[model samples]
Target: MMLETGKIRENHKAALPYYYRMVIEVPEHFQALPGQFLQIQIESKTTDPLLRRPFSIAGLSRNRVTVFYQVKGKGTILLSRLQAGDSISLLGPLGKPYPAVPGPKIILAGGLGAAGLLFLAKNLSLGSQNKKSVVLLGCKTKEDLFLLDNFQDLGIPTYCATEDGSFGFKGLATSLLTQKIKKIPGKGTLYACGPNPMLAMAGKIAAKHGWSAYFSMETMMACGIGLCRGCAVATINGYRLACVDGPVFPAEEIIWGKLPPHPPLSPKGRGLK
Candidate 1:
């Protein structure tokens, strides 16, 4: 991992409510791939929130990187205050990236979890040729969705699900996946990143259908590197650090029952309802 200073090219509210997007212009030496993340040092002069916050790379170009986040706590509140021309510390391109697989592909995203898959989708679209790929997104309502156009613009078929029936499908994204997967003529790969319950369900569906799958696990971290050992994920092989070993792992390897339950959503907001 490299420690680099990048200037805020743009930091503003996204088209969706309760969400924000930030773009950074980094030096030539900095590089990253989809599924890797950055540890951003929040500029709080007092150090009240001492640790850096982890954000998945949403989009990346020659020298520009984008991250999407929700303001849910003190650290994020500070992050939202940053503006254009601000300089920020970034330690990243950390963690393993999703593996490239051939054949038909299916991407499943839940709420803000969509942030981590955009880059992967972009790469997939470039060499898609005869391959069939699709994206299924889930949220509480239509208003809770964002980046649907970004995916659609790539010509990848995109579908959405909302709990309240405000959008595409009237149920959960996993339900949408179930319906779509059955229609595929042959076996394909599954890639998912979302709330634990959503991911667990996706894993189950993939296993039932005998499709290969990978998942990006979200967890708490004090240090982005493996030194702290704070972001352990329970797996069939025992606990693995989400930072070094993966934020992404083979779906069959994870022990879903051993994972900690996602915290209850607060009145303010939390990922997908």
Candidate 2:
């Protein structure tokens, strides 16, 4: 795909403090799937905060793209300053996108991990009657919640959990998932992305219940195009690359927190069925 540039059409903070959404115009060639991400270069070289960052597409339209992110680091803090009409270079519609499908859905997100799962919920639930999506969003407090109404507006049920008991559930989102795993049918699938701990927990839960799930990993990448091999991960058979293999995988296939002892041919290479 040709590298197309975009201008930020709107940047606004939602209910979440320091978490914002930047909507930019996507060129005609930029076709994005849910759970796909874009690499954004923030123009603040002198300042410690204006480095580059990657954000998942939170929502999409025919002409524009929106990314939602938290102010966790310097790069994001600068990108938050983008406003309507500000131009930015985007290197995506990159990476693989979450498979858009129908079934009882659960968007499992932890903190910033919500970015990848939110768009999937929005895309799949579009035009469904009483959307079956059950989005479990985890944060430290109510101030950390993102796009609460966006899901509700789509008729998707959403649940919020904060460590401080400032919202819906007072425990971890995985704990909430633990309780509901048995309720889903055979076709039910869990879509998760977030911190390592959250992903680990989800992996364990899915394995125990025999439920199908997809995971979007948070890996460090030097080159987004699968060349540098900096983001190699251990698989059940051996080490696998995250970029070319997957940023998304079946819950049972990944090795979890560490690389597998040996090299496992990536399910990504052959499209594991």
Candidate 3:
């Protein structure tokens, strides 16, 4: 809950067309974890866009923080224009992170949603000798996919799916999950982050097989803190603020049917390709 000025070390278009990767040099005291996000002030001198934009943390190092985001609206379009050495305002490391779970784990990501899971995958790869972890990514087409090499470089098994049959699996990433879930030996954990529909479907699949699952929910937010109840998410226990309560919640707690319709992506939204 601190407002800090971080310098953009690197900001450029990523492998995916409309997506960009940004590396910020933060204060040495700054700390963040996977599943948490930062609220970035897109413009420093004007109030045209007004509110800050939220982006999940993709990577973290001693003095750096990285984020991957798509150019969806005016705010993101402005973000993509930022260059290295630009000073940016950040409010963050906010929201709860995914709980540490041992044993076999399956990570499901769709489109830009993969951005949030990259840090988690890195953590899982450490001392991963006995743990069986895999990443299933979905996107619209071959060109929509990014960060495959980063995941593969970690020595974690990674799979991809594209709706156009231009890549790994020919179908939704959820379909691939259905097939992979069958191969789990005992109880395993499912971690997912994607468009609302994809997450809803992944939750259902996890429940059907009696697997423990957690999901990172996405929504619009005016304030990155709990003061503004603008990011409320419907849960079995009533309403919860996505900013503080979670961007991550256990699968069984969410009331999927109550979630708003998934917003259509300009080109494509988060999910496996």
Q: What tens digits encode model 2's per-residue C-alpha lDDT throughout 1-273?
A: 246678899887764456677899978667878777787777724534333466788878888887887655556656777678988877776677776555676888887778767678777776572356678888767776766667667667788888889988899888888877666656467888877777888888877876678888767765566777887766775776666676777767777767322232122333211
Give the total clashing residue pairs for model 1.
0
lDDT of 1 by residue, 121-190 (tens): 9889888432599999898888768778888888899999999999899999999999999998788899
Worst 10-residue stretch by lDDT in candidate 3? Answer: 264-273
TM-score of each: 0.95, 0.85, 0.95
Question: lDDT for every model?
Answer: 0.88, 0.72, 0.89
Model 2 scores what on Cα lDDT?
Answer: 0.72
Put down candidate 3 lDDT per residue, 96-208, tens digits, no spaces. 99998877899999988899899999888876532598899998898878778877888888999999999999999999999999997877889999999999999999999
Better of 2 and 3 by lDDT: 3
- Give per-residue lDDT, candidate 3, residue 155: 85
Where is model 1 poorest over a 10-residue stretch in terms of lDDT?
Answer: 264-273
**Better candidate by TM-score, 2 or 3:** 3
In model 1, state the lDDT of residue 7. 96
